[model samples]
Target: MADRLDYGEGTDAQQFVFLLPEYLKDTSKKMKTGLMFVKLVNPCSGEGALYLFSMCLQQLFEIKLFKEKHHSWFINQSVQSGGLLYFATPIDPLFLLLHYLIKADKEGKFQPLDQVVVDDMFPNCILLLKLPELEKLLQHVTEEKEIDKKKYYKYSREKTLKWLGKKVNQTMAALKTSNINVGARVQSNAFFSSHQISSDKEEDYICYAHGLISDYIPKELNDDLSKYLKLPEPSASLPKPPSKVAAQRQKRNK
Candidate 1:
């Protein structure tokens, strides 16, 4: 006779155990039952796979419960009128299930109970399971044993040095052309001035001097001077040329 079957809530809505049929326990009738019992007791190998499978089953069963509720209310209406039903949205859970299944299969646990529960809940659940492409990419990275630290450091250092050199060259070139008195004597005179220049006037004088020097210096000479200093390239790009319209207006006035 079939074993008396009883289903009750476990710790959570998803947690439940099924009492085996009496025939399943009869070792002479089925050797598969013994194998299944052993697997149930020792699930470490396929734990991840089973966990994911169970989650999917719970989600799918929840969807089925909603479908049943809808059916009860809309008995007169068509099943299609119940609206669309999704076991899990956001796609993450489905992907996780697929990942675990792949791992389980790789580990050689083909008939995991979690997988069984998922299959029982939705016969077409395999259709929903998708291969995680990102997981495949991650696996490739994880499987690689060797890392080229020296090559990485070499490239990083080269890039950093190139950037720093460019900035320093520019700064030195600006300092060379500036009227800020780099010479010790001039700097001392400026610092100990009995009649100091006003801040506004000093700024105006610096700007005017810089403009004059910039106008007088040839492009080639400026480049050579900058190269000699071995400083970083300038932070500021050269100013744009005067507009053709402005130039034409100046020529007309002349």
Candidate 2:
């Protein structure tokens, strides 16, 4: 058989398993950023990609913020479907990941899974959002009491573009940095073992919540995923991902 990828929930849903470190195995102690597993019920299509990509960004935000001292903002569109907007800081991802991870862990979602596969699934898409545009959305959403769905989508699209443009500019600047100092130095090590080191050579920039970089995944992996995903074509507006060296540098910096 196909190894029955279904995790009791359904076949369409993808379940990711994360082994908790020995320190996190204790239920009595609380973890600030420990995730056991994650389940994506969305279909593996464009729509599903959007939500999954958003989740990856959230995780990256949390990882890069505490470890790298970078910060950004995000609002869960799924939560805001009821017309109430809740802006979250990058730190919020710690809690968000915990919530989903706990649920999946309890149900043994996709138990006995390969950790490598799960790790590879992350950074599937890099979104370059402008900090100022995020600020604008935060201001607008907080001040406004009632927002229709139509207006929300329209506003999100507009602001997202502005954010992406600014993000591109920032990445370009980082690449041009003669000293090669991407941002503030990170004293502490990353919590996740898969964290990448930044490369010396500049490539495409993935404007994540905490900071920006490129080559989140291996070239072969990206090429494979490209077969299924209709990712945005490389354009002046959208920068390409960095080379393998840049990815290594990202890991080292992390």
Candidate 3:
């Protein structure tokens, strides 16, 4: 959920509060010039999304801002209105690579990873090719060939489905272990002093994990994953969601 901010019409100066991983501060000592913000394709939306790239660490981070109407923050010496809290989370580079591979798949040709990743609109996509062990990561979702000692890859639907299944399983296990309340039966008893929420139904875990995982892939692949997992059809009455500011798909006029 990376965001690209814009100064809205007639907007006032605002303050930002961020919660970041400690590792970033540690990594900063190695190099200063390699840190930057770049726009690249969002694996889930196939749209421009902002990301923070560290060429030194070869790491990519997803920035997510949490905003609420009429919120304000009081710093040590001043009060700032429209204050928002942001988080920096590590993103799986493979997901981003898969986005390009799926698009390249339409060409019906095995192409070198570098050739396949070129983006005219978001040229910084080349930085992704610099990530370490990229060949090993691509093995999860691609079929490749070696030509003249160079490797070429094409998206492998079979392999990708298997990989996504594993992702769902991993997310589901975390949900269960964290004692998340995902079922209506659990939430309905929220006010009861004697209630326990960890006993949610098995389907609850699957649905919750699917919702979270869907944010990282395109709608078509999401639908395919749903079917592959045999998830029950979602009800049409519920509207989709994500409230954030961005020039990306996640953005809306604030």
Candidate 4:
């Protein structure tokens, strides 16, 4: 797959290699318009980011680009530049909805989900409300009040923190199960840590898990989660996750 192209005439046209959930392929066979890509507000950064919305499945997937230097793909006797790969992974819709809910909280009033999730920048955010069990998911992060058979919701920081804590715990458990050495202070651009920590160091697992979770949450929320999880104080000098480190390196190259 990494073979460099050296043969015949190659077009300057760009080629993208994508990795998507296998289920989407079957869904595509029946309907085409149901699956599409859109730019939506990134919950963590509030910036425009690519997302795949499945109107058929009422699901959302996060889109990420993977690229590296000195890499090429030989495709049907043509060379493709940039050696870029795109990934589409399924994501929880609530994480994206939480961004708007927290913002709407500034008003400190219970409102319908429709009003709370509106985004002028990325109007497609409304599609989130269409996801199944939104009411159930919202219950995890918001306080709901039913009046005259209609439900209204308001963001509850207490509940959100608790939910985030559960997420941290889940991530920590996965890290330990996978034997990841997130406790080490060494920096390397690989998934495996260069330095190893004892498996018994539970704190390391928590801190490492927090760092991974930090990628999905805002800085302020991440700080709050750090305190919630009772991990060590965060320091900027610490090494970031391999994916984040690679992204920073790519940004610098650009």
Candidate 5:
């Protein structure tokens, strides 16, 4: 019964279905999958939805699909490829996969079965984490004191990667059941001097960096990615203005 479910229903759904035959035919084709590394500044803690998702994937996918050679290449290539540089932050691996999936889906290059594959593995991926929780997690990490900065950053990065690996494993495990060969690997590259992490402008810099990656993504996938990433929406409530009485009191004092 689960095999009959059609998980593709958005604007580009039909295009994905149309591409399935090609993927099926080229089952033996080997393509080098690349993950451009960017450190995540804030990550959801505890049983944070994204963290849980990552944990699941690591247990299920990465353990099975990722080969040593492929993993090495992914990390090595990013350093060689060269692009806009930014400070490394702790990022969930599943989030990275989702980003790639969004890019492929938007290009109409992803197969429908692949969507089903994602659904089976991460049925509640987006639902698990709320926007506020995600935002708070980032704030918590970035707001740490300078004295404990290195320790906090290391802890966050390790924890984030651990969960991410789990998520990748889970996703791959689900794909294996469908006879799909899916995999994930870790990659790291040297940070460029031009992309130094500035303390004062970190927030805006990170936001813009994420936007740059999102911009290159196809339109169909952009909305979904934004939604998943908790990007602010136009209809979201604006912050309340200062009280008139408080404003008047301050003016009088001045």
Candidate 6:
């Protein structure tokens, strides 16, 4: 398997070899001009959805998140590649959406933002000590002597990934309700299918400064991007079941 390029956190702007900054600049201009590049199916209608999306992006930059290389890479790749690399923005969109909710709460929208929403919005910001609050459970396991630590880690990781996937789908649905669509499904599937982390994972995870490399990325770096963020690969489609009548006919012929 060929290695894929991973721009880990992309902190420096000087390393992008094949990236076209002019395209990013043009996109920002278009986004500001209220032009609809992608079809949106929002209830807000007109330019309200675009305005809100722009506002979110603006607020994101105001908070200094725009300096984050992941975001820069996301914005550039998304536009330069024409949405082929939409997932390059590994940060959850909800994190950005939280700013809007916070503003709405300040204005007495929806009876103030809930504490749960605050934590959801700022998971990395909150600090807690010790076990904090605990909830008791009625059911008890009789024998819990031996669980394989590796297996437990794998199981927990799988469960967490599953939960995150559902949340992502729900967020996408919510964004769509607001008439915002991010990427084409076909392109997304192709991205996932082409990038898989396996035995050569160590070499595959090498972090490269985008601007420091040559004008073009190494061939290995073009095949995978697991170092930037870990995501579940899209599953290969299952084969369709054979038709029963056809199977019986074939058996009779045999």
lDDT of 6 by residue, 1-254 (tens): 01112343655211112233242336555555432122211111111111112221221111001111442222333432221211111222332322333234344322212332234423422221111220111001011122443111011223322333444355444433433212222221121221232221221212111111211222232222222234334333311222222222233244
156-218, model 5: which lDDT tens digit per residue?
333333343344345434333433211111011111122233222332232333333432233
TM-score for each candidate, following the candidate numbering = 0.16, 0.28, 0.73, 0.76, 0.19, 0.20
Local distance difference test scores for all models = 0.29, 0.28, 0.69, 0.69, 0.27, 0.25
* Model 5 worst lDDT window (10 residues): 181-190
Q: Of the candidates shown, which would achieve the greatest TM-score relative to the real structure?
A: 4
- Which of the two, 1 or 3, has more TM-score? 3
Pitting candidate 1 against candidate 6, the one with the higher TM-score is 6
User: Could you tell me the lDDT of residue 206 within candidate 1?
Assistant: 30
Q: State the local distance difference test value for candidate 1.
A: 0.29
**What's model 3's TM-score?**
0.73
Error of 5 at 143 (Å): 9.5
Better by lDDT, candidate 2 or 1? 1
Model 1 residue 237 CA deviation (Å) reads 65
Give the per-residue lDDT digits (tens) of candidate 1, residues 173-210.
54344322222223211222222432223322333223
Q: Residue by residue across 1-254, what tens digits does model 3's lDDT show?
A: 11222233476322223423332454453254455667899898789987777675678877676666686654445555664656445688888998899999999999998889999999999989888898999999999999999999999998998999999899879656645555654332122111353466777678767777889999999999999999888844322222223222122221
lDDT of 2: 0.28
**After aligning candidate 1 to the native by TM-score, how far in Å is the CA of 245 from where it should be?**
70
By TM-score, highest first, what's the ranking? 4, 3, 2, 6, 5, 1
TM-score preference between candidates 3 and 4, better one:
4
Write one digit per residue (lDDT tens) for candidate 2, span 197-254: 4443232223221123222222332343333233344444433333333443354355
